[model samples]
Target: MSSSAPWKQLLLNSINSNSHLKHSTYFQLATVRSNGRPSNRTVVFRGFQDGTDKIQINSDSRSCKIEDLKHCPFAEVCWYFTETWEQFRIHGRVDLIDASNSDPYKLEQREAAWFAGSVRSRLQYLGPTPGLPSLDEQPSHDSLDSSAGPVDVFCLLLLDPEQVDYLNLKSNERLAFTTARSVNAYEYIKVK
Candidate 1:
């Protein structure tokens, strides 16, 4: 096992990069349903909390993913950067930062996230609930009241990774790392 901070940093840097050509900010999130089926979807990457192992992503409070997380908090996220031919598979437990949480810090974080959202993005939470049968019609944006700020439906998903697998296709290298919640040190093993 290799506890290499630089390698982990490289992976984090790749994830945090802003290059459009790399598609670094998008990833596939996988969750398990109540019936024991796996579901996957693409989600945009949000910034991580400072000095913490938590990674953040936003979602509609009414989305299926929210319900899935409620039923089972564990999830896996896969991210690939074509430019570097590198992929990161993160195994983690999910936490929802929404109105239900009474923690002042978490509540503050949620508000910040809501305010940071673009008008168009924030409008999504204001529409008819997701995953419901619709009339084959779209909600007019003009009808939404943005002045109310983000609705209660806006949620932040905080993923606390238990393990992270980093693979570089270009170099034909793979490394698996395990994280300890109370320490910054990571233990890793090369898979290939």
Candidate 2:
């Protein structure tokens, strides 16, 4: 275990650096399942808001992890830097971004880009629409044409980080610091 001061400085420095987070692809998201067991999965961090500490994660709200959040709001996220051997642990409360909870303009813009990427990632790689059915497979219901255009059902996971833990594998030490909204104002504590 190590003192929190140095780790907090490292955290602030890393988060502020564009290159540190820019190319990072995956983060570990941990949520308590309905059965009260801990469940974790790898998810991509779309972006994080600077002043608010709000992070946006692109995920299907219908996912098991999302459902777990609905049952239990607490979540823990971990990100490891393979090159630098530094790891960041984030403890936060997770919430689903519904129409009422999210900003319309921001959500819509991100959603449009998300839908486009979703379609391109899945359909474009497959070449063309196969002989199964066109986008509007069900005329009675809304069009299933995700390839044709964007949809609104998709949502972004909002993370309100409360505490952060930092670990330097090279130094063989760990430090824990918390935010104001957490129990204390960034106290340096050793975790053994």
Candidate 3:
């Protein structure tokens, strides 16, 4: 519940230091399925929510990840920076903001995320749901809007970190940044 997550600075530094790599923005998100199984997928990092440490990611409401989150909001984001030889395991709870969401601020974030997306990215959402064969499901060029604005299926996934386990392979150092929820603060513990 801390506004400024202690690990945010380290993550931002890792991102800035390795900005040249395109895959730096990608991370593996692992969620719990309804059947108590773990589902993992690679997702792009949209950015942190405005002025907050919450991680933001664009999602499709129809996506299995959404269903997974509904079953359990908890997830872990695993990010590795090849250039820096560092890895971060962010344990958190995700907040979903879609058309059905009633929160105004979250809805605003969703709208902003939609408009921030490229036309091509926006258009993809109009196609058939993920994992489905799309030959007939494909929308004609003329049938798709270039803007393709935010659809009900387009959702914003925000992750509020509960703990961040950061590892530096080069230095052989590991640290755990855990939230002290009762005090709205974070405790930094060096791990072996």
Candidate 1, residue 131: the lDDT equals 29
Clashes of 2: 0
TM-score winner:
3
- Candidate 2's C-alpha runs over 4 A off are 1-23, 99-150, 182-185, 188-192
- What are the lDDT scores of the predictions, listed in order? 0.76, 0.61, 0.84
Per residue, candidate 1 scores C-alpha lDDT tens digits across 1-192 of 544443458766775563755356778999988887899988877777655667789887888888899889999999889777888898999989888889989988888777766655665566576623121123444455555655787888998888988888878989888876578677667778
Evaluate model 1: give its TM-score.
0.84
By TM-score, the better pick of 2 and 3 is 3
lDDT of 3 at 103: 88
Clashing pairs in 2: none
Cα deviation at 3, candidate 2, in Å, is 22
Q: Of 1 and 2, which scores higher on lDDT?
A: 1
Q: Which 10 successive residues of model 2 have the least lDDT summed?
A: 130-139
Candidate 2 C-alpha lDDT tens digits along 1-192: 332333445755655553555445467889999999999877766555433456677554445776798899888989887656778998888767643445776666455545545443323223232222112222232224565543333556778777878888888888777666444345657884
In the range 58-118, model 3's lDDT, one tens digit per residue, is 8878888899999999999999999999999999999999898888887888999988776
Pairs of residues at least 3 apart in sequence or in different chains that clash in candidate 1: 2-188
